[model samples]
Target: MLHNRVPHILKRLAAIVLLGLACVAAVHAQDVLRVSAIPDEAPTELQRKFAPLGKYLEKATGMKVKFVPVTDYAAVVESLATGKIDMAWLGGFTYVQSKLRTNGATIPIVQRQEDATFTSKFITANPKIKALTDLKGHTFVFGAPSSTSGHLMPRYFLLRAGIDPDRDFRTVAYSGAHDATAAFVQSGRADAGVLNASVWDKLVEQHKVDPDKVRVFAVTPPFYDYNWTVRGGLDPALRKTLTDAFLRLDPRNPEQKQILALQRTVKYIPTQPENYAGIEAAARTAGLIK
Candidate 1:
């Protein structure tokens, strides 16, 4: 009788342990979806803009959404590749990098309508700088070296126009952000600078940068740009859910409209890996990525 009782006690303990393991697995499955974006703007501004979107996503997906801010552009790519984050808002160039690093395991889900035809602006405080060619022999600043509109495409177009920024410019500086690039030029630390046209326009519209001090001297031809990318191994069902949530944002709805406007987008549209081929090609041409 004692032997039989000992066997029963062991079986009961094993069952209890399995039950606890199952509970832990269930809780992990419902863990909060972590999101992050390239530090293209001030961290404070990114947090402010993403807060409402996170709440909206939480309601849409029935999962808590937390917005994580990073210190630089590459951190977003690294986070997505290592599965540290569920999704990220990546510039075209950064998307290319993540795709390469993950061996195409990162997937693009959605992009703004504006992203399909994004452009960059070359700005300057000096009247003598009339064009990209004129930027030669003068100090110039670019936004983050990894930036698509702020650095990559702008450099690509400059090279196309026969101006090699590294060799031709007297000095080159990186401002780390579009607004900072404008401020750098305005403050005379740099004679000319380049940044995303949307950022430049916003700065002008907000009167954050005086028009008289800094003005657009050139605009790069349009190209594909920012997008929401997810890690490759995400459950297909969840990926579709995330994509659908973005598409559901209606500009006609005031609340959704505010979210879209804050993102500088008209509406979110589904995107595929092929959408970034041109961007990848541009990166290769610029020798930014292998």
Candidate 2:
């Protein structure tokens, strides 16, 4: 009787182990879509805006969608490279760095189209300063030295105006985020700062910024900025599915429309890695990375 009972116990244990493995495999096979946002901007704001995007994606792909929140711009790159997240809405600069890290870590589906492509504001205080040339020898603030809108483009415009940011500015400081840079300027900590015009507009619309204290001191030539980037190495089919859903999302869809508004995007246009090569070149020229 004891021998018979021992065999029965072993058989039950083996069956249980096999069942667990099957369950694990089932979970692994389930499509789990993860997404995130660039830093400095509020993740919650993105979640609110992109919530419909996620729902649209889920409905389109028939997969479970997840949104992962990140604090800063670089984190989005790091997360996507490690496969910790499947997709992200990233800054152009961060997207370039992500490619460098994972070799082919990202695939961009859509890029935000602002009203103007050739000019973005460089906000400042000093009523005496009327143009980019007037910024010479004055202190300035730029967001994350790696920031595309906050630093790279702003620096490029400054250089175009014949000002070497590293040399002409009495001092240069990194406030780490556009909003922080705005705060620094608004509080008189810096003479001026670089920020996304959309972010500035939002803050102004919300009455968080006082237009009297800070003004657009200069505007940089418009260049591509933000996009929704899916991690590389994803199944080509899944990537295609997501890319299509994102691009096809209707602007009239109230949920997607609101999110697009926050992102300053009117539509999700198809883009490729090549679309951002100019941004990569700009980063290299600035020496932010090799």
Candidate 3:
């Protein structure tokens, strides 16, 4: 009976040791890379829209990349700040907020290569409206107040035109989504609105927005927009590996082509924090945040 009891205990101990080793090996195999991507616009199906890109990155970086899609722009910023996410794709407004709030927690890695910059267009219902001057005295709508392309840059353009966004327009409303803002103009609900041009363009590309009914009143000067942002203090080797994979994603490559379509870029361009100083200044001037 003593011998049998000893063997039983020894077998149980061996099993426990094997379990511990298996757990460690499983953790080591995961090599997880957590990522977050802002919905293209408010209330969008981000995971549904960007899943292909997430899968592409997983393969490219040889890690188990899990995409945490965010509908609220600000939440994405917070996630990056807390290290809940390893990387993110953010608009300029959220990016600026993340930088400031996270103790400079992240830096830009890439942006769309089109025109080598990103910009927004002011759309108006009146066909004759073709400049910022035309926006004065017209009822205006903007995307979410925190949106860089939809609100901050557009308001800056308004200021440049000698019209204070807070006081110049007959009425100002936030439609929350660029598509809705455009709809407001198309339906004659508002005279003009500011929207993320890339988002609007994608809608037009998808035939969701009528390009003929509402035309661009003005195209703001090119400024940075969407960027691939990664947390600071990331392991240097892993960082280099990931950045290189993104930069080298060729349009001809099937994996890259899908990512380019989602991001509206031919290829990712290397970028840094300083690249967004202008956007940060724009947000501050617009009084969106400190």
Candidate 4:
């Protein structure tokens, strides 16, 4: 009986050791490349769009890549600053916020060709609304406050045109995303709305928004926008590998074309932190950040 009891205790101890080893292995497996993007669109749409791109990155870097989507634009900036994520796709203003929050530790790696000259489109259900001044005393909607093309530049241009959204509009609402802003105007929730041009074009192309109802009344001047940003202190070699992978995507290739079309980019190009200086200044002027 003593020998049998001794064997049972030994077996239990061995099992516990094996379990500990397995836990460590699981953790090591999870040491993957974590990626996320600002929720500029629906979370589900973001996940669908990123699935193929995540696979392509994994194949390129020889590491498992996971795409995480956040509900708000600020969350993406905060996650990148806190190192909760390894990399992020950020808008110009979001990148500016991350840079300031991280004391200029955030790095902009690549941006879409369209991003270099991005613009915002103001749409309205009211046919009489033909200019920025026409929005006065009408309900207005804007995308996420942290969005560059969606909110910052749009508001900046509106002010430049001598129309203040907050004061002039009967009601100012935040729609949280570009698509939602269009929907707001289409549904009569808002008399007019502003959003990124890329989303607006996509919506028009896909027939998601009826051209007969909501129409673009104004388009802001070109400005720098979205980019792929990585956390500071990342391995230099890994960063290079990631950047090269993005730059190597050939839009002519069938598979790569699908990804590019989904991303609304003709190609990805190298970008620097300096490209967003104007955006930072705009945010400061708007009193969005100190």
Top candidate by TM-score: 1
Pairs of residues at least 3 apart in sequence or in different chains that clash in candidate 1: none
**Tens-place lDDT digits, model 1, residues 109-136:** 9999999999999888899989888988
Query: Against the unseen true structure, what C-alpha lDDT does each candidate score?
Result: 0.90, 0.79, 0.78, 0.91
In model 2, the Cα lDDT at residue 253 comes to 82
> For all the candidates, what are their Cα RMSDs to the real structure?
2.0, 3.2, 4.0, 4.0
lDDT string for model 3 (1-290, tens) is 89879989999999999999999996774488888876546444566556787777778777888877666777788888887788887878778888998788687777777624678888876876777877768898988777778788888877876899778789999887777888888889998888877877887888877888877767888887777788776777777877887788888988678777766778777887888888888877767776
Off by over 4 Å in 3: 1-30, 42-45
Candidate 3, run of 10 with poorest lDDT: 39-48
What is the Cα-based lDDT of residue 7 in candidate 4? 88
Residue pairs of candidate 2 with colliding backbone atoms: 39-72, 39-73, 117-222, 118-221, 118-222, 119-222
Candidate 2, position 153, lDDT: 78
Report the number of clashing residue pairs per model: 0, 6, 0, 0
Query: What is the alpha-carbon lDDT of model 3 when measured against the actual structure?
Result: 0.78
> On a 0 to 100 scale, what is the lDDT of residue 137 in model 1?
95
Instruction: For candidate 3, report its TM-score.
Output: 0.84
Q: Write the per-residue lDDT of candidate 4 for residues 1-290, one digit (tens) a residue.
A: 99879989999999999999999996786459999998889988898889889999999988899887787888898899888898999999999999999999989999999999999999998988998888999999999888898899988888788887879999999999999999999999999999998899899999999999899888899999999999987888989999999999998899998888889887999999999999989888877888
TM-score of each: 0.94, 0.86, 0.84, 0.90
Candidate 2 stretches with Cα past 4 Å from truth are 1-30, 115-119
Better structure of 2 and 4 per lDDT: 4
